[model samples]
Target: MSSLLEITWTDPVTSRKGYVVIDTLVRGLASGGLRLRDGCTLDEVRGLAQGMTRKESLVYDPADRYLPLGGGKGGIDIDPGDPEAPEVLRRFLAAVRPIVKEQWNTGEDFGLRQETLDKVAADLGLASTVEAVFAILPDADAARQRLAEAFAVNVDGLCLADLVGGYGVAQACLVTAERMGLDHERVTAVVQGFGSIGGAVARYLAAAGVRVIAVADRDGLIRNDAGLDVELLLGARDGLGVIDRAVLRPGDRTGPREAWLDVPCDLLVPAAMSYVITEADTSRITARVVVEGANMPTLPEAEAALVTRGIPVVPDFLANVMTNAWWWWIVFGDIEPTAASSYSKIDSTMRRLVEAVSVEADRTGRTLRACALQLARRNAEAVTERAGVTG
Candidate 1:
């Protein structure tokens, strides 16, 4: 389906490009994130926006008070580390302020951080990054407070907000392991991109008794045959998810990022950038299962190759649905702001969603992504019908 709306904005000072794509809208509101990266493009944002549409639809629950919003995404082509990047983002947001105030509800994604986005948005006099959806809420102030409380939550020093998505990713891996008849305790995993998602996934998987043997970051790959200390590594990470090599222990070893594919593990998680795994790269995957922690980490041909090799993949949209769902759930009062409430909701919902896709894949003999997209489209149709919407 074609996007409902698309906009391109160029920063006057930096001549940097930015984009916004509203893939679809159930009501008046659309939800997604704004990302800042050196080479972001209209097409990438468009694809991500469409993914957001399926992501929103995938989490639809008739019994819950939260109705999923439509999908939208924003991207700017400026390196996050650039000295003038802040001003570039400010101008881009200003250029899109009208749409942001009314239709586009966004937070942070990829190269952008929530605190930075919130600070910029606040300086622009926007009530919040998600101010667009306030009008639809029964109690906007209450919802804001609830979400704030939720964001402030932590378990073992990790913020609940940062961990929810990774929790969902970990759940997918655990379930897939079970389906493949692998012992969770004996499972070994390698994770790429030690950012928020990858770090949290490693933490949760390690806590679940899965030995995380290798982790890759911007600096390179860190490996430990006996499993690196995930908690220590997490604490050593900076804002950009780069681990401090000073924290390395006796058993830990470091190598180039390419070595990530060489680590013998039962699960491989690409949690960093999009299109990191090409068709040829699939040949290097030794994992029995691949769980996407990042959006569009695997190319079409790579995914097909993995499928041909009898590897099961937990598609990104389904695997990473919890963070988006969790936000709306809190905003719409379907869930409390507590970590317990968030974890419980995400865990149960992810399990059911993953199981549904798995069952459908078995019945139809389709890849998990194909089956998941089928379920999402069906739900999107149901949501549209219930909303009395027609395109």
Candidate 2:
């Protein structure tokens, strides 16, 4: 029989409920984020937890023999955007504080913030010793503040990965261009999200001399043959990463929000949300390369259609896991001897991971998704074996 999946938590204060899905726990503990969104469901949490397990395995493979830490995730189905949402969150945390103190580690996810996490930690009297994926909180109150600060830091650093992933994508595109004997100078790109990752990618690609002909966000799409000023667009971008509609001058304006998809380009990156490239949109994509910057931005069917068209796709799970790995190392205090050395280590690791995926895909004639899964499974199996001996 398979091991039973266990998810347990409660609201001691208000009797409201939350849950922790422990996907695997071979290492000393499991780790994942806490999401508070209205549409979050138990099944969704379980799937995400499983993905976390896979991500951990993929990143830590063939390194030090760290047992699988197990994948864990928790969430509350609440509208975090609501005005009185803070109070609701407080109650939710009051009920689950004890659980957070004990076995299940939680961090911020979508629709959740550090300020609110800090408040929850304070209410539960969780000590500062409790660490999230980013930093260590010295006490409950400090943890609360740290959570907030960590979140701020995450948002602030959003621009950092912009160049990192963009550079990687550009490098990948360059490689693909070389292999296909395509003209690199003529390559144009469209960024389908103006958020940090999307905007950063656009900037980095433009800097590398790739013409970013189009960019879009929640409000609208902007296009210019001469290329839009990435820095200026970023300056005008709002907190939610949406570009202000007022900035879209008549010359820069596209027909509608969906016009971004139809913009002819050599590369198209969906960095905004999941399932953006659905079946209906797949027929319209003209890009030769698609790099996913968001988590699961393309549905399986859409991905298949792209594959059928011979369009190379860089898988989202492979491309985005580096950020999580970096945060994990920082939170775990697993830095190198020197600060500069540590930063270099992280960069090297990310580059190597991306290269490895690309190489494996080429070698085996398999998709990046297949290669990443194979790598993850190999590591997970090893972790599972170690757990059997140790547990």
Candidate 3:
């Protein structure tokens, strides 16, 4: 699908590039996340926007009040660790303020954080990063309050807002395990990336009896034959998702970052940057399944190679749909802003989605992504029809 609109801006001061892609629109609004990374490109942001459309459609339910909005994404090319990162982000946000105010609702992704986005948005005098959706909400004030309350709810020392997406990713892993007839306790996982999504996925999978044997961050890889201490590592992570080397346990093994795909495990989750797994890298994959915890983490050729090897891959849109859906579920009154309620809803919904995708894939003898895209497109059409829009 072609994007409805695309913008590329070059920063005046640093000449850095920033991009926005509004892939589709429903009720005059679209939603996705803004990412900051050293090598971010317009094409990457465009693909992410398309993924957001699929994610929004895959979560659609006629019974729910949260009608899925279309997909949009923003990206800026600057290392988040750079000293000038804040100013670059400020200028990028300022450059796109009009779009944010009118139609695009974006939050943090990849190298970006929610607090940083919020601060910048506020600095630009915007009411909220997602204020665009408020225009269509029945009661904007109530939604604002409810969303704030939901974000404030803490679970197990981590914010509920941060845990929801990774919780869904873990749920997808568990569901996939059940379908493959594997014992969850004996299954091992190797997760690439230790950021919010990766950290949370590791935590929840560990809690569910899965032994996460290896986890890779930007610095290097941490491995333990038995199982790494997920809680300790999660607490030790910095804002950029890098773990402190001082926190390594006596039994833990450290290796080069390039060795992530070499680790033998039952499930492999790439939760880091996009396209890390190339066609050549697929040769080293020993996992039975590849669950994408990051958006567009695997290249098409790599996925095709995995398919030839009979490794099932759970697409990113379905696996990591929780965070985006959670916000809408709360804002649209389909769910209350409480931990119990949110957890219950997310679990049931994610389980249903995973099962649906698996069954469809088996029935049609197709890749999981193909079946999922079919489902998403059908639902998207229905959603568009219901919204009285044509695209």
Residue-level lDDT of model 2, residues 274-299, one tens digit each, is 55788778888988888776656788
lDDT of 3 by residue, 267-345 (tens): 9999888999999999999999999999999999899999999998899998998989999999988999998999899
lDDT of each: 0.90, 0.63, 0.92
Residue-level lDDT of model 1, residues 1-391, one tens digit each, is 7999999998888799999999988778899999888898899999999999999999888999888889999999988989999999999998899999999999889988888999989999997999888987778999999989988998888788888888889988888888788998999999998888899899999999999999999999999989889999999999999999999998999999888987879999999888899998888888999999998888888998999999878899999888889899988898889988888898889889988999989888999999999999999888888878632
Better of 2 and 3 by lDDT: 3
- Clash pairs detected, candidate 2: 11-95, 12-95, 24-70, 27-68, 118-144, 128-137, 128-138, 128-139
The 10 consecutive residues of candidate 2 with the worst lDDT sum are: 128-137
> What's the distance in Å from true for residue 177, model 2?
6.7
* TM-score ranking, best first: 3, 1, 2
Ranking by lDDT: 3, 1, 2
Could you tell me how far off, in angstroms, the CA of residue 99 lies in candidate 2 after the best superposition?
Answer: 4.1
Once fitted onto the true fold, the runs of candidate 2 whose alpha carbons sit more than 4 angstroms away are: 1-20, 36-38, 61-68, 76-80, 113-123, 127-186, 248-251, 334-343, 384-391
Regions more than 4 Å wrong, model 3: none
Better of 1 and 2 by TM-score: 1
TM-score of 1: 0.98
